[model samples]
Target: MSEHGFWSRFLLPGGLWLFLLFVVPICLVLALSFGYTDDLGRAVYAFRLDNYADAFDPLYIPVLLRSIGYALATAAICLLLGYPIAYYIARYGGRHKHLLIAMLVIPFFVNYLVRTYAWVALLADEGLLNSLLGDVGISEIQFVNTPYAVIGGLVYGYLVFMILPIYASLERMDGSLIEACQ
Candidate 1:
């Protein structure tokens, strides 16, 4: 086959997969969003804006704002925490760079749900941390069902993703150029 024909053949499967698996579902959901339930509770699709209007209703505005705030906080926390660790690993890891990266990535090998449950075990009112504090003559402190807990979970979940890319970029950079700029 010609070079163009060869590449197009390779692209065909992926294009079909994307269209069938991703695009079709998204289109269906988008179409359904402008829809409503009927008297019998069956979803009836139509070109309606009421669903969106209810989403942006005054009572829900605070929820939307809080979600946005939480996302921003999570991102900021991840950047602040991940950057320094990535910098240290890229700069000082040297002979142990691969090992350090492996250590960072190892947690992700466990199921995400398992790791989240581990956090719950550690942070719950009757959990390990509270037990440890009780031993030290401290009262139990609430850690779950709070904004901080949510942000911490978000940071934990996303920090490694942020770190790997930052580390890769920093590894590619010239250390001497950074020193010279300083």
Candidate 2:
């Protein structure tokens, strides 16, 4: 085989996997979105735009906006927090940079569900944090079931994804440019 054909053969498995796993599901969902329910409440596949219209209806618009706002808030929080830590690790981590990065990543070794449950345990009104505060004569604070809680959870979940990329870019950057800017 030619060099081009040899290289192309290596892509077959991954391409097939993507087509089967990602593209097919997305196409199926897209097709289903235009469907509607029948009189018997069974889903009927049809070329209708009602679902899209209902999604943008005024009543639901606020919910959509709120979701977007939460996403923006989470991204902003991640950038604000991740940048400093990434910069510190990149610039001053010295020979311990890998160790510091490992520490940051170790939490991700736990299952995501377990980490979230840990957060719930710590933040629940009757949980550890509130109990500790209660011991100090403070009333229990409701930390769960709040917008802040949702955002905090998102930030915690995604912060490492943000930090690693920033750290990579900073590591590749020339130190002289940063010194010159200062």
lDDT by residue (1-182, candidate 2, tens digit) is 89999988999999999999999999888988999888999878899999999998999999999999999999999999999999999999999999999999999999999999999999998899999999999998999999999999999999999999999999999999988999
Per-prediction CA RMSD (Å): 1.8, 2.0
Work out the TM-score per prediction. 0.90, 0.89
Best by TM-score: 1
In angstroms, how far off is 119's CA in candidate 2?
Answer: 1.1
Per-residue accuracy of model 1 over 1-182 as CA lDDT, tens digit each: 79999899999999999999999999999999999999999989999999999999999999999999999999999999999999999999999999999998999999999999999999999999999999999999999888999999999999999999999999999989999999
lDDT of each: 0.96, 0.96
10 residues in a row with least lDDT, candidate 2: 36-45
* Deviating ranges (above 4 Å) for candidate 1: 39-42
Error of 2 at 136 (Å): 1.5
Per model, how many backbone clashes are there? Answer: 0, 0
